[model samples]
Target: MKAMRVKNGLKISVIIMFIFMYGCKQSSYKEFVMADAVEVSESYEIVEEKEMTYKLNSNQTNVPLNLKIIKTASSRYKVKNIVTATRRIKIIAQKHGAYISDLRFQNDLYKKENRFTIKVPQKYFDTVMDSVNTVVDFVEYENITTKDVTEEYIDIETRLKTKLEVKARYETILRKNAKTVEDILLTEDKLRIIQEEIESAQGRLKYLTNKVAFSTIQIDLYEPVEYKAEPETYTKTFWDETKQGFANGWWYIKSFVVVLINLWPLLIIGLVTFFFVRKRLKK
Candidate 1:
């Protein structure tokens, strides 16, 4: 009976040890899961912060955006006098704070024409057009054109912002993460390329803005003159004709003398052969 009691006691002890080991394992598993949860939460917070930063930067950079429109016009008309009309147009353009970018004047037998390329403020485009119309006698044609560049403008702006952000990130990496000389040089080259692209985008934006702010007007002013017929044939006086005839005769005589001089050796050979043949025939 004592041996039986000892064996039962040993089985109970073994069961208790197994229970203690399983509890320890369960506690360690719980601790590991909690650590993973904390890391995941921290990563989510970081992602949310980055998203907020992007939104804030985007809003700050793009404010007061407006539609970009480029206006241009062309007008062709007849005027009483091209010079007078041109002067009047120049004065009108100056009064409206406009300038002539190009001017060309042509005078032919049938007409006189003056072409002008005028740059005017967008607000004064219609006013300038009306002012120019006062000098027109007859309208040949008038054309107005408009181009919308809002999409392109916004697209460039967005791309530029993205490039700037990328450049900033690369700069941070270069400052903090780049360890080798090769890595530093590669980052610098990438930065140079990005800077060139940024400058090009900036230039294009400036051009578009300028075009939107100002308008172009091309004007062609012309004056028609009476057609004067030119003589088909010129009639020379009798003394003029006599002089021309004498000059032609002198030229022919000089040409004949030159030809004879060039053939002098051949002429001597022919004469010698004729003399020899004649002497033989006479014998």
Candidate 2:
């Protein structure tokens, strides 16, 4: 009975230790979660908060985030005059320190359209959009979009750091123990591959940074023809209308004379029938 009591006590101690360790783990995990919940800028919000919450409760350590915000504006307008609007758009781009990246004009039976793609500094994105809106007569469609690329930027930066570290390690190995020619060549090849990977990551990071810095705007201007009613002619006097009626009667008479001249044989047959009917009536 003593042996059994000792065994039970030992089992209890094990259970208590396990509970203590689990409690400590839970505390640490909560702290980590709290630390990661940093406040974001007004222009941004946590895009993957749900995913992060799921990961924190699970065995996952890596958190997915969308942190970088890229802004784009697009506007399509149906203006009374496209030429003036196109000129105004160009001026707006220049005034807002933006550049026209693409300009296209299409003239078809349906409509005349002027398309422009402009690159503007991120700080002036709103100002440029407002300027375009002010110049347009009426807006057909307008859209502003924001995309978060924080996760991508972070991933590329992490890969770059890892590749650089790997390259340094390969360099150190080459310098320390590369005695044989084959060993040296192999180490150099590894270093080259790592260096290439580092460069690729760096280039991608730079591209994402530029995209975040600058905003793109696309404007489509169209001019639709407005319908107009035909002008009404002034009313003529009664004498003028009577003269016109006389002219019309004369025209009708000329047309009848031409028809009779062309059908002389038919006219002769009709006259003979009329005479025969009159003579039969007299008899």
Candidate 3:
């Protein structure tokens, strides 16, 4: 009985050991499978995110640009010299892929000025400005303005696309689904409005595009007034004194005439009184 009992205990121990080992293996396999599933899910998410990011990046059609306008004032010593500089400026502008949009000049005793408005291709804007700087003797003022229209441009582009899509939808409806005259007329009206909006947006886009592609520069050149004095010779001084005396004499004669006119009434009264007094004395 003692031996049987010992054998039974050994059998029980072996069975328990086998069951524990099998359970541990099963748990490890399940954990591995779960980990693998988690890894696959994470990888899929990463790929999906990458794809989304790429799509978003690809949607941008053009780079946003800032429109710039530059203004500068330069001076040359001589008024005539400014003309040469102006001609040279025009030549330089043309060589740098620029054009003179406006030119104005003023020639006067006080000041001489030459103003130019130039439009330069954006790619050559800096080159043109540098060339212009070389053409002047002195620089007075420089102003540069930049406008960020990226948001505005993008908004307009989006609106334009939406409008075009709406227009196409209307056209499709008009061609395929409009069964009655009323339907046709209504669709046509919608199409017209959409078309007008599209045109307006197009015009605005074109203006923005031009502003981005070209930069404006205003250049002002001037020569300040110079007063000259010449030394007077003795003969010239004598003539000047003579002319001054003649002017003073003329002024005195005019003063005498004015005084006589003012005293006429008093003189007339005095003369009458004298006549009356003489008559009384004679009587």
Candidate 4:
């Protein structure tokens, strides 16, 4: 009987410990859920982007993109070198320059507090403010973006590169090669790629040469604002006023109709009851 009592006590102790442990685990889970719920507002601030495309040139346009940069005083540059070294590609970045912008690559992530510029042919407007993007490296992210601008960029560079290279080669062949048909034919195909390249390059060059040849990049490092509500839209448009008025009137009519339809049964029953009561009283 003593042995049995000891066994029962041991079992009771185990049950108590297990219940205590389970309660602790449940409390921990509730705390974790509360923490996650609190963090939701911060999660919404994650970086997001949209792609835009534009036909930036009517004339062959090429713009020379001058990139200026500022970086985290010392550490950022070293981090950028590490990123460039590891990837074997320098993701070219620029400054948001009325004065300056800062770009930092650290924690294996590219962080730009400055502006970025890419010399683009007017024909390749869709390509810029793109290409440099996050692959979601589980540890790092990359981003390159464009600034708000009243102007667009053009592509003239590719054409120039091709033309110059071709021009050099054509002169070389004309001066060096014997007049064999095969040699001439091969040279001609080369010339065709060169010609297309030249034409394309020229098209972009012309556009850049004419459009706003320079752009100012404004760097913003703060959280993006969906509304700038300080000294509001002082010159708010007539169209907006008209649209609001139209929406209010439309809503009022729809609401009135919905209430009428929903109350139809009540209205009909009341009408019947009133008529019956009136007829009986008169009789």
Candidate 5:
């Protein structure tokens, strides 16, 4: 009897372990499927029908990104053009937005800053972004993307039409007090899908419209200081100036001595030039 009891206990423990393992595995698979799936379906029959009609197709499509890469500022003229283009774009997209940059002071010295944005044709994202690097002062970063949403656009159109027709039918049934429980559930689901698709399409159309209408080019400009030579100016009475010069010369001599005392390196070079340069070069 003791042996039998022990055996039964072991069997129960095994069964419990198996159940826990299976539950964990099932949960993991569910998560994996959810993460990997597309939110919308591929069956775009209604969307296609609407496309033949007078409906917009943005809901089915998404942003196709064309990121720019800039290297050396090869042409100042191009930079100027880009600046002008950006200004025009800002004015046009004023209702949408004028994307402004944060004040990024590079260092203690105040530097000249330039910014620009360009909107290339969506189809030309790769080519335009690649060209950006050639005209920029420096390439800070780059991004590029291309997405085809023909299927999504089609799917949404089909769904929206079907839902609308179904909703109309449901209203008829509701007026007659004939909508069954299943009818209500079905109508609710269809309405939900229609609402979702409409929102999705509107968002996509807004994005595409923005892209087509405006192109932005972020630009920065740097100008190096160049040297110029000028004739000397001497404005002094000879005797007075000479005396003043002597004083200034004496002051400089003192300063130089202090500098030499601090910089052994300059002292060594000076001595070498003054003493050894002639002798060494003579050979």
Candidate 6:
């Protein structure tokens, strides 16, 4: 009986040892799995970021396919009649869905001129020019200018996209990793700066888009009048000259009186000096 009891106790000790070992192995495996999951999550995030960046770069590279152009024209010409020509041009602009941005009319001694600044759609630029030609008697000059802004447009769009991505990352950090007030404040400040830059980029893009959409045409229309010659020298009638001479004499007398009044103090002093000298001479 005593041997049997000792054997059973030994058996129980062996069983306990095996259980403890199995528990340790299970714990280690669990820890390893957790570590692997964390590493995988980090890798996935990295891949997603890289993909987004690649897409943005691809879009930027394709900017040259669609060109951004700004067109402007200036025309100076002579017309038969300023008012009639101006009216006809207005009708033409209205027919083509264009508007006069500015109009200036001036009548000089030798000519009448009307200046117009018209804004037309890009598609109607050539049509408007041709229509305006119908009213022109003589074409002094016509200048057309084209500018390419594709590079600048691409640059702004790319920068805006980058800034937006950075802002989103900062926001994520603020929400998840910012544990202290200082960290939160710093993250918010960075986000504010990024937002401002994004808004600036958006505004520049809008202005460029508008400029590309519309074309500007400046028209100067003028009409020449017959020359009127004036006499270089005029001879006044004898009666007119006599009247002018009398008026001049009266003006001189008035001027002399004003001078005497202005020198009253000096005149008084000279009279006193003269009287004193005369008295001394008499004595």
* Model 3 C-alpha lDDT per residue in residues 1-283, reported as the tens digit of each score: 9999999999999999999999999999999999999999999999999999998888874653453332332323233377788889889888877888888899787677888788878888778778777877777667776776767888999999999999999999999999999999999999999999999999998998888777888888887777645557545588899999999999999999999899999989999999999999999
In candidate 1, what residue range of length 10 has the lowest lDDT sum? 61-70
Compose the digit string of candidate 5's lDDT tens values, residues 129-155: 455445545455554333444455556
The segments of candidate 6 whose C-alpha lies over 4 angstroms from its true place after superposition are 1-65, 229-283
Q: How does each model score on TM-score?
A: 0.58, 0.55, 0.54, 0.22, 0.30, 0.57
TM-score of 5: 0.30
Worst 10 residues of 3 by lDDT: 68-77
Order of the predicted models by lDDT, top scorer first: 6, 1, 2, 3, 5, 4
- Greater-lDDT candidate between 2 and 4: 2
- Clash pairs for candidate 3: none
lDDT of each: 0.94, 0.86, 0.82, 0.50, 0.55, 0.95
- Cα RMSD (Å) per model? 32.7, 27.1, 21.4, 36.7, 32.0, 31.9
The better-scoring model by lDDT among 1 and 6 is 6
User: Considering lDDT, which of the candidate structures 4 and 6 is the better prediction for this target?
Assistant: 6
- Expressed as tens digits, the lDDT of each residue in 96-116 for candidate 6 is 888999898898779999998
TM-score between model 3 and native = 0.54
Better of 1 and 4 by lDDT: 1
Model 5 misses residue 265 by how many Å?
74
Q: What is the lDDT of residue 1 in candidate 6?
A: 100
Worst 10 residues of 5 by lDDT: 68-77
Sort the predicted structures by TM-score, highest score first: 1, 6, 2, 3, 5, 4
Candidate 1 local lDDT, 1-283, one digit each (tens): 9999999999999999999999999999999999999999999999999999999998898865577889999999999988889999999889988899999889888999899899999889999998888877988999999998999999999999999999999899999999999999999999999999999999999999999898999999999999888899989999999999999999999999999999999999999999999999999
Predicted structure with the largest lDDT when compared to the true one: 6
Clashes of each: 0, 1, 0, 23, 19, 0
Write the residue-wise lDDT of candidate 2 on 1-283 in tens digits. Answer: 9999999999999999999999999999998877666544322455577667887888564555445778988889988889988888888889878899889999776688999899998889988888888888898998999998888888788888888888888989999989999999999999888888888888888888888888999989998764555568878899999999999999999999999899999989999999999999999
Model 1 TM-score is: 0.58
The per-residue C-alpha lDDT of model 6 at residue 39 equals 100
